[model samples]
Target: MIIEGNDPTVEPSFTLSNRLARQLWNWVWLFLFRPSPRPMHAWRAFLLRAFGASVGTDVHVYPAVRIWAPWHLEIGNNVGIADGVTLYNMNRLRIGDYAVISQGAHLCGGSHDYNAANFQLIAEPITVENHAWICAEAFISHGVTLPAGAVVAARSVVNKTLQASWTVYAGVPARPIGKRTQHEH
Candidate 1:
């Protein structure tokens, strides 16, 4: 409900405090978080936690991953977010345990309302359930939920909530291509 029906011309999409906090976070990310060594996962987690992110134990969020707002992220235990991933979580983005967000993947939790004259920004939550594997370069749209053990093939574009668990999805508007072997994690 960030900017649901408001006109962008008249009012700012984000509050002044929010903008200022983001600016501060950008500086911190550039100097402290982004420049950290690849093996310094604990340090990065500490930095993210300081900025209000709920990062669980042994989470492997790579150095090149770009997170728009740390406060909106909730990463569970053993989650692996690889390099070049963009987490544009304007709203809450929950990543369950054992979830793998591969390289160059984009998880966008916000979009613009095209029908609105002012193009109001719409923020929605995105959930990646336990053991879900979002393959390399995949794009997970706003409000979409990937159920447990779902495998999104490389470069797939998922704009809707996937129906089946333990399934593999591929293509532009990702459809279920096959079933994945469900393994206990």
Candidate 2:
């Protein structure tokens, strides 16, 4: 077999201790956090804080939500992460106060640089501003930012920034559908 130029077994950029801690936390997440009842949001938040996540007050992360690398996560007050939501935060991921990540929504902060022969990992920060809503099953790609009060419709895929505040976005690439009025809750 021909030898490849790049080493496939090369370790990721993170420190060994960080990786080990995350692996151990996975067990704690599954056993302690996942099986807990809905009212245990505070307890789960406490556990997340113990793992180095900066979680604000009254943030409700449902039992089925999956968070990769909790240390990279920063959530503000009153944020709600519904069931089946996935936060794949290989880089910094910030959710502002009053943000809602609905059921099955995915906030992905990492991707592969396909141009590299080794398929190198690329990471970027994801930000959801205050009062933004990510609807059910929506996918927010790396480096994407949702402005304050912006709304992403169900099953939408957002690959770019939703710049306008109080706007509604939908569709595969997530185009701005309409503006949300202040009076409309």
Candidate 3:
């Protein structure tokens, strides 16, 4: 039953991902996503595995990784998440295949509930389209899309819509810096 405007777009969540409601950040990750500090590569996979992240093979996660909630994230194949990166995925945060998150990049999807009397809590889904590159210290605010093959320059603060496919965006709020060509290699 496919309706046009009334069609369904999302699924219902019935339970929280974590049952214990406790954090053994090091005690758990150390046993699973263990980092040798020497090999570097081994530690990368180990850390991801520890968080129950569905990480693809050969995906490199730096030691400085900061994941708010690993269960809410989905990273695709051949991904490279650099140092000083934050995956503040309070809800669903999807990173597509072969995406590069440069150092100091922030993937923040969590926020406070600004409506209720208490302004208790809020968080939204942030989908990073496939092949996007977020440069150093870039801040992607909640629910912003970085389209496929989009390149965000250093220190860009993206709080709005970002178009896909071979676009170069750079600014305080991140705008189209230049038009890229298919053969601009």
List candidate 1 segments past 4 Å from native: 9-11
Top-TM-score candidate index: 1
lDDT of 1 at 185: 67
| Candidate order (lDDT) | 1, 2, 3
**Model 3 misplaced stretches (Cα beyond 4 Å):** 1-22, 29-35, 181-185
lDDT: the better of candidates 1 and 2? 1
Give me the overall lDDT of model 3.
0.72
| Model 2 residue 141 distance off true place after TM-score fit, in angstroms | 0.5
The segments of candidate 2 whose C-alpha lies over 4 angstroms from its true place after superposition are 1-6, 9-14, 183-185
Q: Per-residue alpha-carbon lDDT of model 3 for 1-185, expressed as tens digits?
A: 11122212253221233433215554554544444453486566655556666777667777667776666778887788887898887678888887889999998886655554544445778988777889999999888888888888999899876975779899898989886554321
**Per-residue C-alpha lDDT of model 1 across residues 1-185, encoded as one tens digit per residue:** 26456678888798788888889999999999899999999999999999899999999999999999999999999999999999999999999999999999999998888888889898989999999999999999999999999999999999999999999999999999999888876
Most lDDT-accurate candidate: 1
Write down the lDDT of every candidate, Cα atoms only: 0.93, 0.89, 0.72
Cα error, residue 42 of model 2, in Å, equals: 0.6
TM-score of each: 0.96, 0.92, 0.78
User: Number of clashes in model 3?
Assistant: 3
Tens digit of per-residue lDDT, candidate 2, span 1-185: 11234444674556568678888889999899999998899999998998889999989999899998888899999999999999999889999999999999999998877787776667899999999999999999999989999999999999988889999999999999999875323
Preferred candidate (TM-score higher): 1 or 2 = 1
